[model samples]
Target: MCLISFFSLIFFSFFLLVMGISYLFNDFVLFIEWEVISLNSLSVVMTFLFDWMSLIFMSFVLLISSLVIFYSREYMLGDININRFILLVLMFVLSMMLLIISPNLISILLGWDGLGLVSYCLVVYFQNTKSYSAGMLTALSNRIGDVALLLAITWMLNYGSWNYIFYLEAMKFDYEMELIGGLVVLAGMTKSAQIPFSSWLPAAMAAPTPVSALVHSSTLVTAGVYLLIRFHVLLVDTFIGQLMLLVSGLTMFMAGLGANFEFDLKKIIALSTLSQLGLMMSILSMGYWKLAFFHLLTHALFKALLFMCAGAIIHNMNNSQDIRTMGGLSFQMPLTVSCLNVANLALCGMPFLAGFYSKDLILEVVSLSYLNMFSFFLYFFSTGLTVCYSFRLVYYSITGDLNCSSLHVLNDEGWIMLKGMLGLLFMSIIGGSMLNWLIFSTPNMVCLPFYLKLLTLSVCLLGGFMGYLVSDVSLYFFNISYVNYNMSSFFGSMWFMPFISTYGVIFYPLSLGMSMTKSFDQGWSEYFGGQMLYYSLKKYSLFNQIVQNNSLKIYLLMFVLWIIILLWLVFIM
Candidate 1:
């Protein structure tokens, strides 16, 4: 396993270097197509696109996968099925790679379904009821996107080819192509967990922390963003684009708000990932595809680092994930705590960090754009909420007094895990600056008022202070959570999105099914169609049999009626 990790890391690094050079000098797109079958001017072709974007993205995917695998060596050491776990992780990464390189919708769907299927397997790896339920939610939520992708592929059939890249520009304004574009956006939204589809992301934390690091950071969640970036031509200046902007903005705000209220260590990080994904989607919707992509890469670096540190902490703490039970870990595990702090601050967009470069630029671009008031508020407020949650996490997990029992021992003893985290820690600190230089040929020129320029920093500081104060025990008489229990629960529960995504979505359909079963299968159709007909036929058949028998009672009744009629006629005369 270690050998695999070492070789994979070296291979990814080499390719990343090669691709970076290619991106700088050549910047060319290479398309490979082989016709599998053709009939009547229609061709079924296997298509792969190797451009700077796809190559670089694939490199990052492999790079992160290698590190996660390295980290998992120590993390999953006690599990008897370690080999199977690693195999599943590799499969997940391969699916992501297939997704990144494919230009054809049919091929993309192959990779897309692979991701959904493997993710379900990984999510349910623990074989517990919680894992099973979470896995179901995760799989079902993603199936929506899979269905959308299928619909988009079917729409692409109208274009006479499954290669969507050929029709991206045409899809922008063509009335007939808008539906395909809309389906593409829907696909991206569900895969990326935007707005109403977001409930699965946090629930996915039931998986092993290594899976969380890989899935939340680079592979699964970001697939949607990457898809949107590819389809940006269709989204720009369109109704679907505007709707994406609104939904993504709401998602950002909702995730940030939920993160502040969450106590689970992995869950808080998961929510933070959702928030960043929202930022990426929002920028993509605004036609800043490059900026969104920039953020995506930088975010992957730090988030992976963050989750690795989280995984280490959880491993040492006997698998306790509740932040409330942790405190004063800075004394024992200085290295892990430092890495965690760096990742956290980077997430908060501290100056000179990876997150700062892309995030600040995104904010500046958003401010410069002619966006509505709602979007502007969501952007800044979500930024602040990000800081709030990070500080809250830091305080509870690192600074507060040890809240667990005295028998517990916590330390950064696992050198293997530490090595894995250290790789990402360095990248988290310097990655944004490096990527900034490589991605943007010319720096964007944005001149804004001093106060407007200061807003991002101001919000960060203000959010930090608020997080500290809100978390301080002295600030409240009762538990702060109890003061606004209902509201806190609402925010913490992600606006009841889990219920909406799982129960709410299925409730009406299932209810209607039951109603139909009762009314038709059991009631009206049962009686009126088959059973009622049988009863009617039986009654008529009995009456006919009696008539055929020519019963004496029936003959006597007929004679009596005839006599009565004759007597009446005689009386009248």
Candidate 2:
């Protein structure tokens, strides 16, 4: 099964890559439709769109999936339900593919729902309380996006078609189209783990590392970004677009801050993924969807490599995921450490690496645009925080003396896993430049001032130095003197986002429900509505029966008494 799946995925990836190149060079978009039903003037059709973007995205997805599967073969070698795991992963990839190619709202919902459901399954694959809770959080959070899509579908029905590609241009001007655009943005936010919906991304680290590498890092999280990219025409200059900009900027800043304060290795990477996602979303919201897509692709390559390296490290360290327990493994696992450093550097937008091309372009574009102070600072500061956390991570895990027990053995001899990491490592180094040349076809001339051009690099250097200093024991103690435990906890806990998303969301609704039960469902509603009506009817019925069943003797006695009283009154008058 592994062999067959691997070969098929690789073959199709190459095929799609070639097709994508052809499509891009020719400036072609092919739409194929099969009608299922027609009523009056409306038709229900299943439609597939083949364009450069979809084709290339699919190829990348397939390539990553193949490598992740190959990596998982060794990662899950002794698992009893490895087959089930593989099938779930394949289903996830299929769902993403469906979402990528469909221009129809109905079809997109089908794919969207598939992704949410399958992801929940994968999240809880380990059968533990933590996994189950994480799975539930993931499923419920994504359900919001699903509902948004459903609303979008319902709204699109008014336009007499489920295919949204036809309406992208019109939506910018039409009121209803704007509403649909808003809904789509909402959907994207939930799926991409932007703000309020952000907590689930880290919680989802409960899934196996392979799933994290393929699904969370590269594919599922980016689904929302891709959706917005497809709908960019409508969102380019609208209120919803601006709203997305503010939200995504906040998300980016929040995630970057959270990553710096985190201790768990997987959670830190997850937060980094969230940070990068926010970057893509912010760019997309600002109307540079092409740049956003570029970042998405580049991020997918390096982030996947990051996860694989983390997986290898965890595997060697007896499944210990805490970074505090790790240090100085360079001698034992040089290959993994080298790849890990490259991936981290690529993530930090080091020159010529996969992230550098896209991230640098995004920063330049953002700097040139007329943005508010909040957004401008958020972008640059977030960039710095990203470097800070990354360097801190490297410092703790690869530079200091080994912190684990002397009896422990750490090595990177798993060639099967290393093979997958190496595949992505190569891409992490060169994928950005290759993709930039192909996607742009022409260079972006950013005529920025010298200071602005140097800003991104300067922040990165400052962030790296701070990362090292902050991780130092004496410096940490010095900072702790000023920084209280609560402040540290707040930052470490993602600004209490998990609590906000779970308790903050659930608390009010559940409280309202309880109040309703006390005031209505179990209280006045029952008394006035059901119980009051029943008592009123019963009282009236009993009175009527008493009148109907009156005795004749009693009636005669009362009639005589009434006659005597009438006579006496007549005489007095």
State TM-scores per candidate.
0.89, 0.89
Q: Give candidate 2 misplaced runs (Cα > 4 Å).
A: 37-43, 473-483, 506-573
Candidate 2 residue lDDT tens string, 1-573? 776788899999999999999999999999999989999987778999999999999999999999999999999998988888999999999999999999998999988999999999999999999998899889888988888888888888788888889887787789998888888888999999998899999999999999999986668899999999999986677788888899999999999998988889999999999999999999998889899999999999999999999999999998999998899888889999999999999999999999999999999999999899999999999999999999999999998788887567888789999999999999899899989999999899999999999999999999999898878963556777246788878888888889987775556666888999999888998998998999999999987876677878767877999999999999999
Candidate 1: tens digits of C-alpha lDDT, residues 1-66:
655865776597667658755865677778899889999987778999988778777877787788
Deviation in Å, model 1, residue 302 alpha carbon: 0.5
lDDT of 2: 0.91
Best by lDDT: 2
Clashing pairs for predicted structure model 1, backbone only: none
